[model samples]
Structure formats: structure tokens, C-alpha cells
Target chain A: MARWLLISVIYIELIIVSLGTSSVAQGGQELDWAALDWKALDWEALDGWELEGEAFAQARYFPDNPLYIGQHSQNQSLALELSAYRKFSDSFSLEFIPFYRHDFQDDERSHLDIRKAYALWASPTLEIGAGINKVFWGVTEAVHLVDIINQTDAIEAPDQEEKLGQAMVSLSLPLPSGLFDLYLMPNFRERNFPGEDGRLRGALVVDTNNPLYEHKDKDHHIDWAARLKQSLKDGELALSYFEGTARDPNLIMPLGTPSPVLLPYYSQIKQLGLEGQYIKDEWLWKLEAIYRKGQPNLQFEVEDYYAMTGGFEYNIYSIFESSQDLGIILEGIYDQRRDNALTFNEEDIVLGTRWSLNNMHSTEVLGLWIQDADSSAHNFVLELSTEIGNSIAVTVEALIFSEQQRNSDSGRFTADSIGHQMRQDDYLQIEIGYFF
Target chain B: MRNNLSNPPFHFLASILLMIPLLVQAETAEQKGRAIFEEIDRRDLNFGDFSSDQEMILRNKSGQESRRIMENTVLEGGNKDINDGDKTLIIFREPKRIRGTALITHAHQQRDDDQWLYLPALGRVKRISGASKAGSFVGSEFSYEDLAPQEVDDYTYEYIGDEIFAEQDCFKVKRVPVDKDSGYTQQFVWVDKSEYRIQKVEFYDRKATLIKILTITSYQQYLDQYWRPGYLSMINQQDGKSTDMIATNYVFRQGLTEADFSENSLRRAR
Candidate 1:
């Protein structure tokens, strides 16, 4: 299949080259002018379409013993992301992106997703789009607390940057004061989690096949969202609201069941989120806050809560008189429910520093440490990426857990103590990608 | 001495000597250099808005080559008091991985420019500090400062002399950057005396060493008043690398407004 694709690409390039040369050649005769017109039309047709993609191979190594049986300390995978875009006219365009990954260790890790398949019509004042799409809405770098349009593709990575496309119809209005966007999402997609054989799985395997929803419509329940963003002279403010099923599921372990597995429960939720970013020369202040209601807790009771992630990024450029930039990020995470919050970052601090080498290769390095305020637990992450050439890129990542001390008062394990559960899952990953 | 001064020829010489200081004070080197720059700026004004397609070919010492293609749009802003800088948006279409990526820049005359980068894959826009103007532009040999709009207030100028370059008489001028964060301390520019258009520039690093040379060629006239370069070549003397840039498909007076250059426009750059 790869060879066939290469040959087809070469064939198209040759035709384009020949057409270009012929168009530039003499065209004074009537017949030659007619041929030139046809060639120009063909050229326009070719110019309206574009195809691009990247193929990557990834490997991960864990130094510690696996907590679950059937899990390995080493894993490998291959993935491809291809996108094709076509401009029908100046006002309309279509984009289709298909992604696939194959894992050698776990069956559930191998998956396919359509990242984007959308048709859009845009004018000076309004834009209308339909089909499967991905939308992100947030400002804080530590975590995307306000973004809810797409479901998390958790199996892909731990950072939650990867998302599964959501089927929706969206509208955008650009006004004098700000930009307003409205979305009507019809189909609800479930999040992807690691299988039992995967290293990142919890103590009990999650039975994704049997998910329970609070609404009778289940996966067919319609979701709606809207947002208004305004850019000021030195800052930006955005207000967003979403009404739909919560992306974060509540895991329920059935009692007295023959198969010990956790069932994911999706609850309906209404959330109001606010995002702000203020830029003052070398310093950038960011904030993302969300007020959510009608989400159940571990006790299966509905609860209302608010969460916020606020921080500032200080950029220092040309350190040591070299073409390098250093940025320090300090964000504070807060949850109103405190211990009752479903996330591990109830009250935590994230301190990170990013070093960028403004060179020909575009090398960058990021280091982050997330420290829990109540406990001594901490999560350390490091990432480095660099380009080998115009088409090849390499990335390295490491995740480590340290000082995870379990509560001595309650000897039993609880769902809120995810940091303790992930203590032994430290791993190092490397990825090599070829782009075209 | 008194008798010589009383003579007619000596009196003429004395008057000329007296007038020499006045003439020097009337038009100093700095003032003449600044006037030339102002002329160039004035001729390029009133082009309300424009969009163009640009291509860059980067070559290493070993002769390996790579190509980058992008689309650029500019909205004239400095003419009015409310807007003191030009707004520019650039969208990349080549080097597949960076396709759909966009950059927006608000170039200012007396202060650091405001810039933002939009990554299409991540659906995120990141603000870049203006202090990084010396950074390489998309891994190319050209730096951000090299491409940014040049304002007369950003530098102090001195008229050097006149020289014949490329068979055309040109005026040589030296300019020192006013911003301390600038990578280059001074630069020498050559402008054609006839059209008042820049023809070549020599950049000197902070250590006062010549580092890079840029030459503009293939001049094209637009609207019967403005001259635009169709091709540019930048060579790095210290690195032995070079880049060739070609611009085409120019559209002038497209009726673009300030709204079109907003941050929301970055998302719709494609």
C-alpha cells in the first residue's frame, strides 16, 4: 500500500511538472492557446486539493514490575494520521482526517478514529460548519478544564491533548465586540481507556462494553454548547456553556458479580466555563474556571461543584545571549469539593518550565512537576522534541511518580487516590515520525 | 592677515568659510538619511490592503534544498492615529506538518511588536514575546526582525556616501538599532537614488562583525507608484548558508478591514 501511494504521488508530480512547462512554452497559435486554457483549468483543479499526513513508530519502557498480570514492561506501537482538504470555492471547504494506531501489547490499545471530517462555509461575518469536528476551548496550560466539545482519547496519551471528533453542527458570528459560536452536537462518543492488559489500567478492569447513562437516550442524547470570546488590547476573555453528558465517567464496581469489573456511568451535566488571558510584555496570565452541576459523586448522588486553574507564564528570551527562550509556568488547581472531587488534582500546584532552542531544528524541552497540597505525592513529567530534517521528527517523554504516601487512617483503597494507584506506572516513551 | 581679509578674493573665501558651518547645520548626515527613509515610506503608503503568495527555498552548505510555501495578507494601519502599526497574517501551506499553522503580527514603530502563533493541529493560539525577534523564522535563515515592517523611529541613521551598484547609482546609509534587544547593532543599507528603493543591506552583529547580506531583485511597479521586489536572496557570512525567497500573485487594495486582521482571523487563515 505504501509503495502504491508513493508511485501515485510521483505520477501526479510528473503531470503537474509537464503541465507547468507546457503552459510556459509558446502559445501564439489558436490551437496552442486552447491547449493552454485546458492546462490552466487542470492546474486550478489540482491547486484546490491538498493531501498530507504523518506516520510514526513509538516505544515505551517501564522499569518497575507491572501491578497487573498479563501486562508487560515494554510496549511498541505504530500510528498514522492523514488529512485531505479540498477547497470547493472561496467560501466553502471540506476537510477529512483519518487516524489509526496499532499496539503490540493490548487489543483495546489498537484503535481507529476520525479526527476531523467537516464541511465549512465561511463569509466575512458568519461561518457555518457541519459533520464530525474537534473544538478546544481553554487557556490554562496545566489542564484544559473548560474544553468539552470532544471526548478524550485517553489510550493515546496521558496529557489529554488527543481527542475523538464529535459530530456537530456549528455556527460562528464575528461581531464588532467579540466572536460568538454556537454548537449542536447530536451524537455522544465514549472515551477510550486502557484495557486490562495495558500498563496504565487501574486495579480493576473497566468494562467499556456495558456503560450506563443517566439519560434514556444514552449515546444518542443531544448536546449543546455556546461560547463568546472577546480580544482586548492586551488580553482576551471567553465565556462558554455546555449542557450534555459529562466526559468524565463515574466508575461503579458491581457487588457480588462473577466478573470483577468496573462499569462507567455517564451523568448529565450543565457547566459554565470562563477563560481569560492577559498579556503584559514578557508575562502572560491565564485562567480557566468551570461551574458544573448535576454530576454524581462516588456515592451515586448528584453534586454541584466549581473548579479553577489559574497561572502565569513568564518568558525570558535570549538567555546567555543565545537563540534560546525559557518560559516558567506556575498554575494552581482548586476544586470546591476538595476530597470529594473525582479528579486527583483537587488542590494541587503545577510548576513547569519550557526551554525552546530557536534554531534550524526547532528543538524544545518541557519539564513539569504536579504537587498535591494535602499529600506529599508528586508527578514529574519531561518531554523533548526535535526535528531531524524537513520530514522527520523525534520526541522523547518520561513520566515519574514520587513521594506517594497513602492515607494511614483508611487502609482501604479509594477511587480518589489515583496518584497512589499510579505510583508504579512510571515509564519512558520515544516516538519517531515521518511527515509528508 | 587683516590686509588679506580686506582683499576681494580673501573676502569671498572668508564668506564661504562662514557659510560652510551654516550649510553643515542645515542638512546633517542624520537628517539626510532620515529624509531618504521617509521618502521610501511615503511612496509605499495608501496601498490600503494586499495579499500575496510567497515561497522560500533554503539551501545548506552541502547544497541540500527544502521549500516552504505560505500566504500572507497585510492591512495598512500606520496612516491613522488610532492604529500605529501594520497588521499582518501569514498561513503556512507547505511542509505538511506545519500546514494550516498561522501567525499574526502587529508591528509597532516605537515598541516591541505583538505576535501570536496558531497551531492548527492543537487548535491553540500561543502568544510569542516580542523579545524573540532575533529568532529564526520557521527554521529559515531569515530572522523575525528581518521580515518585520521597518519603521523610521526604530533606528538612528547616518548618510555614508554614494556608490554605483549593479550599474545603478545608489546611496549608502548606516543605521543603528534603537532597541537594545536587537541581535544586530548596526546595518548598512543601499537605496537606488532614482526610485528611492532599497537594493541591498549588510547586517552587523552585536559584536560589530558583518554577519549577513541581503539583496533585493526583480523590481515590479504597482499602481504606477509603488515598487515591489519579486525576489530576495539572504546569505549568512558566518554560517555559509543562504535562502532564496520569491513572492508572486500580488493583489492590492483588497478592501480588507481591521476586523479581518483580528485574532479570530488567524483561525480562518486557511
Candidate 2:
């Protein structure tokens, strides 16, 4: 297993080196050089502190969701985060962030993760960085299935199963027609158990501001990304890739087992996304689509998978003089799995409304119906969020889930068929935050 | 009884004569208050050649005094286009900290006005948009719009009533916002009994909330004809910030021009 993992790690590194060198040769741009104007870094341009940070306490209670492992299981979780950033100069600054999350049920564990801790050197045409960072790639509202090429979460989950952190160097260049960003990261495992291997990662992301109509001045944008694991936006797009292996591919296997250990597989994921939004007076409409392939971690089996997702959202405000806004969302996903078995498909419909009582207070109600290969569920959520003062905010959420189907082990029903009968679950969450 | 019925016209004339004194007294007070209010308006319109010294105390939402400062400046004209070929400048001299910083704003009667802010740190001037006038200025209790020259034609005013303010008789006038986008819905002003100068003005937001209060104190006669408020303070009810404008020097000169209001000229202003 160790040999297999080592081989996989080496292969990934070779691929990354070859791709990065070729792109660099073709583009003729140095990855480590920083070309930023220092005069742009005047602190006075920011004026009034421009310093903001927030801390919050949140609790979630989930009851009887079809995706749970057992007949019924409930979990409670708590999380806290703090962040601070100050501009030393207009083009350079230092930022620090510390975060912690603890789960009370089941595993009963806690983890502290640094979401962002770095110094940034930025100019109108370039940006350079060092430390923990996040990259944004897609423009979808509900679920950005195509944004998988980057190292950030496109889904709703606040925690990432893969703790991906690396010593990274990035560069941003503004082209005459578009923006190009690239990144190069070296892998150093802080906690890799035996039989697990780790390697370097790199990525590139490109965004083009293009307009579909001649009369409109570029309301639409397109993003393309390719990476070894995932890279954030504003890095490099052409000369970037990821080269890393799973930490523990053979968790419980003996040291010298004859059984072939899961080979560390080197994979390259690529993504393409497009988005357009139009706003006329009080009416807003948006449409987005994304496509992703070669997601190794997303594979349920030994083979890789690909997914394509698209969604649309519309908002109409003050339709009846009640200061009310109506929003509707629709999303669809197609997932191609390995082994030519158990393909995943998802479709969702969401309807929501927001009522503005004043500038400082608002209430929202949302109804969502999600259908997947194994189950279908309906969720109704209501949220009331208000700013009590300049630095204090409170939000309360009530959610009720209705599972329409249950999975059975009789082999008489397929996973897709069982998903049709999944029934409902319920949950509640509340959060209060303060900023200074 | 028969003789009284025949002389009914004479009896009615006597009754009319008796009511004249009461009517005269009511009319006189109204006339006095209106004159004072109009004089205050005129002085504010032609506000030039006046200066004073003042101190401002700012409190936060937690009822803590966050800052205190003393300032002095000279006022030119209250017209929005005072710098437009008029060459009027309001120069600050005291408060060692903010000394030499000038706020140069050009007002236009019908269109949006332009403002130039000169900061000591940058040693350069920045042009600010007129759109921001709707909000509070530098966290002060008064909006930037309130600090600018207000055209009397922008609002239709009504003489509501007479009352006593700060131990002095005054006239209460009501003014409504005629601009559709004004953040304020209405304003109530009180004029002093003797000087025809505004003593207080209360501003209400669109939601009918009392958002700001302006009080004028310490009056002085300029050019022996124009009465000017030596000190003026505005308190923001929501944020608890206050701004006091004190005049320290007064000079009357006809040496300004409209050519000075151009954007290019503002960048080159000394």
C-alpha cells in the first residue's frame, strides 16, 4: 500500500511539473515575481478604519433526514470564528483568522481550522499572496456543481472532509481583454497517518468579462479553471495544477498485506462556467451553468466522476406596495459515476419571499423541494434577521423537512426507486453575531 | 324698546369697535414673528463676513463621549454656487489639528452641485459626489444636504403658529420637502423674536422619526445690518454625533468669480 501510494504521489508531481513548465514557457510570465505599485498603498484612502471583524455562535438540530445512516439520529453542533485585517498601505495588508467547530453528538469532536491567515500585496493589475486562502470559480446560486476545480466550498456544508492546506504562491495578471490568475502550492502534511502519501498542488483560473448584447456593457462573465486539486480564483489559470495523494488509503490493512492497497490516483480536474444577470428597475433575473470533471474525491467507487449543473433565479420587488420581494430558483444536476453503476441525478425547486419592514429589519420565508437518486425531500425554512445596532445582528431560522420515501434492503427496489419514497425531517438553527 | 329697535345700526357699529383691539394684538404678534423669520432666512441666504469659535462634543451609541474638538472658520455666501465665479471660500484656522483644511463647495440653483475636499495627509484635493449629500456628513448629526445652501424655492413654507423658544418669543414655521428623493419628510423651524434669526430647526426622516436637531447660539451683528449666529451646533439623534461650526473671522469682498467653480480650477485651487 505504501509503495502504491508513493507511486501515485510521484506520478501526480510529474504531471504537475510538466504542465506548469509548459504553460510557463508558452506564456513567458514568472510565477514568483511581484510587480505592484507602492504608492497605491496609502492607508488614508481607506479613511474610517475600514476594519471589520465578526464572531458568532450557531446551533443546528437535525431530526430524521432520509440521508441519515440509521432509522433516526440527531446531532447538535457549535461553531465560532474570528477575523481581523488592517491595511498597512493601499496595496499591501495583513489578515488573520481563527475558527473552531465542535459536534456534540455521535463522534463528539472538535476542530480548529484557519480559514484565512496571510499577507496580501495587491495592485489594480496584480496580486501576490502567502498563507491560507480560498478561491471562488462559479456563479451558481443554490449549488455550483461546476465550481469543483477550485479549493473552496461550492455547497452549503460549512466543513470540508478533505483538510487541504499547503504553502502556496500565487500571481494575478490583468490581460488586455480578461483577467488571468495562477497558483503554485507545495504539500506538507501536518497529520498524515501511515500508508498515506501527500504531494504538491497547483491551479489556474481565468475569467473573461464579456457581454452578450452590444447595447449592454458586459453584464455576463465566463470562468474557466484547471487544477491538480482546486485553486481559488484570482490565482493563475494556465500554469497551475494539484499533486497530492490521500492521507490514508488503506486505513486498517496490515503492514505487508498481499491485497493490493488502494493505489494513490493522480487526477486533474477541469471546470468551465458561465453566468449572466440583468437588472431593470426592481426586477432582477440571473442564469448560470457549470461543468466539472475528474473529481477524485467525489468518486464513490474507484473511478472518477463528472457533473454538470445549471440554475436560474428571478426576483420581483414591491409587486403590491407591501415592500415584498418574490424569488424563484430551479436547479438540475447530472452526475456520471465510475463502474458504470449508480449514477446520481438531482433536481430542485425553491420559492422564497422577503418582506422589508425597514432598512434595519427583514423577514424571509423559503420552500424547497429536492429530488435525488436515492431520496426526495421537502424543506420549509423561515428566517428573521435584523441589525439591532451598528455592531450587533441576530438571526433565527426554523426548518421543517418532509421525507417522501424510505430505502429498503430487500433488493426489490433500486436506489433511484427508493429515493422516490423518502419522507420528511425537521431542524432548527439560531445565530447571533457581533462586529467590531 | 321701540326706540332701541329703530337704532339697531348704531348698536352694531359699537360692537364692531369693541373687537378691534383684540384682533390688532393677534395680528401684531403674527406680523412680528413673520418678519423675524423672514429676516433669519435673508441673513442665512446672504451669510458672508462672519466668524466665531465653537466646541463640539460627540457621543456614541453607548452614551460614551468619543471625541471633542474646537474649531473656527469664516463664512462667505450661503448660495450653493458661491464658488462658481463668486470666489467665496470658507477657511478653517483654529483647532491646531484641523487647521488650514478648507471645505470648498460650489452650489448650483437647479442642478447637482460639486464639492472638493482637501485633506492634510494626501496634500491633494478629491472631488466628492453630490449624491452622498443625502446621508450624514463625517458621521455628524447633520446630513451633507443640510449643510449646503438650501434654495427657498425648493420648499413651500407655512407660518404655523407662535410660541416661546429658549425663553424668547418666536414664530414656528413648517417646511416640507419638495424633492421626491429627499431623505427628510419635513422640518420645523423656530425664529427668534427680536433678531429674525433661526434659533432651532427639527428634521424628521421619511419614517416620521426625529432624526436631527439644529440649535443656533451666541448671535452677533455683521456690518451693523446683518445678524449672524456666532455658533451653530447640530446633533444627530440616531448616531449621537454632533458638528459645531464656529465663525472666527468675517470679511466682505467682491473679488470672486464663477470661473473658479470649474472642475479643472478646483484641482488647481490654493
Candidate 3:
């Protein structure tokens, strides 16, 4: 608790310094900010034009948990991200970002290190990009929290993968009734294992803001996507489909006899998913379902998995009169996995509330209840974050578990199997960051 | 019931007689206003030589303002090929910080319009696109289409009625858009009856909202034949911003030939 308090004080001090200096500079006459001139030029005047470049900086900090019990200690880290962007034309631009980090903890194991980059080109009808970029899927605010997954470990859950290399292209074509967009992507890089070869993916994305049915008007819209996915949103979903040769198959087996080696080939592993969403004014509701076929080989047999998720999010306005926009989200997910080695079924109900306090401050609190056919568990998470200015943001998060499942005990045929035993673990993390 | 209704016939006749004069006055006023509006719409004002000083102010939603001063010179002619080519030069004087930037717009009715913008920072001139004559100059309330010299044949006008604006008796006229994709659905203008100059205009957006209001003030006649407004102010109701153009100097009857409005001439004008 003492250490957490110390980190919080330091974080607040740094923010005050940065914001005070920025405000002073802006108030002075040294910098000239010009308003846009609307009538000086003709139509198509901005087409094929480029603007001069400017430089900026950003910094952030995450503090330790203030409330917890038993061996409570906080982990804190700070990172700086620098970026530059240049527009070659109205349709094309290039961007570069570089980042560095430092952790306050004495142990080197708790430190963070990463390098990430991406580029994008956009036109009226086409968009293309390559590098380690983040893509979001699903439309529901609560159920799609899984889609908001970030690659950087310093900013996201420690267990999550931060970056992956991929190339993608998307094109939008206007149709008589509406518009149609097609997207294709191929991911060739992995974070923790040898890069997989001979694996490619594609998706068809259709977005329409126009009315689909005669009874509906332009305000009622829909977005749909069909994707060929080799990886799931969460790593837990990858436990299924064990066929297809791994780049390092030996990494999975016990270190004794020769690990089974399979020829490089394409194995059939497929999943079909559909999501429908309806948004009207302040009300939003969504339903989603996915089913995947398991792949099996001689050494290990994987499982088939299916899951359905439904949720609604409502923005509450009359609650806080000033500086805060609050919203409540409710979601439920049911998942089932069946295989020769094991069969597991689970259902999760999550309730969360998010508060956006002006442009500079925001916080979210979530409670998760998991009911397994074999056991039950509860998890609670709270995150508070704020953007100090244009360049700086800070976040602190805490996660607590009532009954946890460990990887070593989650499988079949063991005394410590997840079905027969239970354990609990709590994690607290703090991060401070700067960007330029 | 039939006997009672027949007893009130004399009272009904008295009410009808009372309304006749009111209706006649309304019809006569509309007729007089329409005639004046049609006369102004039919004549195309020819420009000989003109110069004016303008003050421009750019503001944001937060009510912050930036001001600029500019000078303009134009040599205009009619459709009879009297001055087939002529040039208009606009120069910025103050704030002295942006004094060296200039814009030269040349008009050639036979071909396309050409313009050049000269920047002091780059010390070079660049050609501007003519295809954008129908588009907004800068995300502003006035589009490039509004900046073009009003051609007599470009629009068909209808006189609506008489109205009082800023204590001036004005003729109200409605202009239907000829271009299909014009940002405005229709424009309503109130022209001063005596001066034959536009006193006020209400621009209706595609959504049928009163998006922009333009008012003309301080008029000065040039060369005794051309009545020019010294100040024109446009207020964007939605964005809370206004642009005010104020003319300071005037010169008439400058000899400018048609050859000056060509693209080849734009490169040489600077």
C-alpha cells in the first residue's frame, strides 16, 4: 500500500508539470493557431494537396490499487510513444511510430519492452494497410469488449499478445441499392511461437447505412462480415483444432521421445459466425453466435466449440449533470467444447458500467460471473484512466478472482484438474506513459 | 330552421363588402413588388473598372476571431466580346504579417476560368482547379458557386412580394437552382427598391433550414452608373461564424483587354 501511494503521488506530479507547461505555452502568443478559411478556394481545392508537418509529445501513468487484502503490491511502468505522419496526396499518406518504456519495479522480470509500427493508405473507394495494426470486430459495447483487445502488453492485459504482422486490403463499391465493401487479410506472424507458413485468411465485409427493408428508414442500418479466421479473439478458443503441422511441433510434447512430426499441409479447420445489431437513438442491442469444427490428428485430438453472445448497452444522461457521460452494459455468453480428451461447458454473465468524465477523465468497472458445468468462479475488474492533454494519458487497473483456473490443472486425468480443484489469484498493475 | 337562416342574409352581405378593400390592397402591393424585381433580374450589370478594400474575419465555434485586410481590382465586360479577356487581382495588405500573398483570377467567357495563387513563403505561383467552381471554397457558408459573377442567363427568377428590411422598401425574389447538385435548394433575396442592389438574402440548405443570412450595407455608386455595396456580411447560423467584406477604394473605366483572362496570361500576370 505504501508503494502504491508513492507511485500515485509521482504520477500526479508529472501530469501537473506537463499540463501546466502546455497551457502556459498555448496561452502565450508564440504559437499561431489559424482558423480554417472556407470560401477562399473553389471545389476540389483540397484534392491532391498536402500540409506541413508538426511535432508533439504524449505521456501517461497508471497507479496501484488502493483497496485490496493480503500481500497486496503494485506493479507500475511508464512508456513513451513518438509518431509522425505525412500526407503525399489526398488519397495516400505515410505514418511512423516508435515507442520506449521503463518500469519502476526492481525485478527485471516485471519490465516491459516492445516495438510496433503500421501504415495506412485510404481513398474514396479503397483502403490498404500492412504492419502490426489492431482491428476491432463485433458491434456490441459489452460483448465486443473482446474485440477491443490491444497488442501492447504494457497497456493491455499482461497475458494478451501485443503485436502481430499482417497485410490487409479493403475496397468499397457503390451499388444501386447501397454500398458493398470487401476485405481480405493474411496474417503470417506469431508472437510466442515460430511463424506459421502456408496459412492465409480472407473476409467479406458489408456495411450499409441505408434502409434494408421497405419498412425501415435510412436511420436503421446494419454491418455484416464473414471472416476465415485461424485464430480466435481469445487464446482460450485456440485449444480446439489440433491438426495442421505446427512450425515447432515439439514445443507442445513432453521432452522425451521423438516428437511426432506431420508433413506441411492444409488441414480443414473452419468456423462460421453471424452477428446482428440494431441501434436507435440511445438504445443498442446485439446478438452473435459462432461455431467451429475441430481438427484431429493421431497424437492429439482437439475439440469442437460453439458460443453465443447477446448484450445491450444504454447511455445514461440524467445521472451526472456535468463532465460525465455514464453508460451501463449487460452481456451473457454461453460456450461449449467437446473432444475426445475432455468436454467442458461454461456460461458467463458480465455487468459493467463506464463513465466518461469529460474528454480528460474516464473509468470503467466490471463484474463477471462464470458458471461451469463442473465449477463456478467470480471475477471483478476496475479501471480508471485519463487523458491529461492531447499527448498524455494514464490508466490503472485491478483484477480480483474468487476462484481461478490454472493451466496446469485445467486438463483431463489429473488430481489437480480444474473440475476437481479450485484456486484464486489477484493481480494489480499500474502503467505510466508518454507519447510524441 | 329555413326561416331563421333567411333572416341573416343582409348581415352576411355587409361582411363580404368589408373584406373587398383589404384583398385589393394586398394584390396591388404584390403586383408592384414583382414588377420591380423582374426589372432588376433582367438587366446584367456590366463592369468597367472597379477597386475595393475588404476586411475578412474567420471565427470558430468557440467565438475566437482572426481578422485580415485585403484590396481587390477588377476589369469586367459584357457577353458581347467587348473585353474578351480581363484580369482581377486581389492583394493582402494587413495584418502586415501576411502582406505578400496575392490571388489573380482571370475570366474568359469563351473558354474556362483560370486562377493563380501566389504565396510569399514559397515565392512561387500555383494554378488552381477550375472544376471546383461549383464546390465550397473552404468548408464555408458560401460556396465557390456563390463567388462567380451573377450571369443573367444562369437563373430564372420569380418575384414574390414586397417586404421591409433594415427600414428599406425591398422587393422579395426567389431564385430556383439550375445546377442539380448545388448545395442550396433555393435562395430568397430582398433587393432595395430604389438602388436596385441586393439588401439581404436568405439561403436555404438542402435540409430546408435557414443556414445562412447575407446582408449588404454601406453602398456607394461607382462612376455614377454602378451602385456597389461597400460592405457585405455573411452569417452562418449553424456554425456561429461570419465573413464581412468591406470595400475601400474604387477605380472606373480602366482599359483591360480580353487576352488578359486566358490561362497563358495567368502565368504572365504574376
TM-score of each: 0.87, 0.44, 0.43
Q: For model 2, how does the per-residue alpha-carbon lDDT over A131-151 read when each residue is reduced to its tens digit?
A: 654454433344544333223
Q: Write the per-residue lDDT of candidate 1 for residues A1-436, one digit (tens) a residue.
A: 2223333544565578666657665554444655557666566545656778899999999999998877889999999999877776877877778899999998888999878777788888899988778888888888889999999999999888989988888999997758899999888889877887788777788889999999999998899999999877677899999999999998889898897989999999999999998887778899999999999865577889899999999887657655577889999999887766777788899999999875556678999999988888888999999877678889999999887756435664433476676678899999999998
User: Sort by DockQ, best first: what order?
Assistant: 1, 2, 3
Local error of candidate 2 at residue A135 (angstroms): 2.5
- In terms of lDDT, the poorest run of 10 residues in model 3 chain B is B261-270
Which stretches of candidate 1 lie above 4 Å from their native place? A1-47, A408-416, B1-25, B57-67, B79-82, B206-209, B237-242
Q: Write the per-residue lDDT of candidate 1 for residues B160-182, one digit (tens) a residue.
A: 99998888899999999898878
Computed on C-alphas against the true complex, the DockQ of each candidate is 0.29, 0.03, 0.02
Give the lowest summed-lDDT range of ten residues in model 2 chain B. Answer: B261-270
Docking class of 1: acceptable
Off by over 4 Å in 3: A1-74, A99-122, A128-132, A142-155, A158-165, A169-187, A192-268, A295-300, A320-323, A338-346, A359-376, A405-425, B1-8, B14-270
Instruction: Give lDDT tens digits, candidate 3, residues A1-436.
Output: 2223323543454466555545654786675233112332221233333222212222222233322122124334444444334455544554333444443432222223223233445543445543333343344433332231122231224323343222334343433212333444332222221111100000111111111221122111121223322211110010111111111111122234353322221123355555555443344566667565543322245556566777776655323322234667777766554222221223557677766542212233433333433344555667776544333445566655555433334354321132222132255545443332
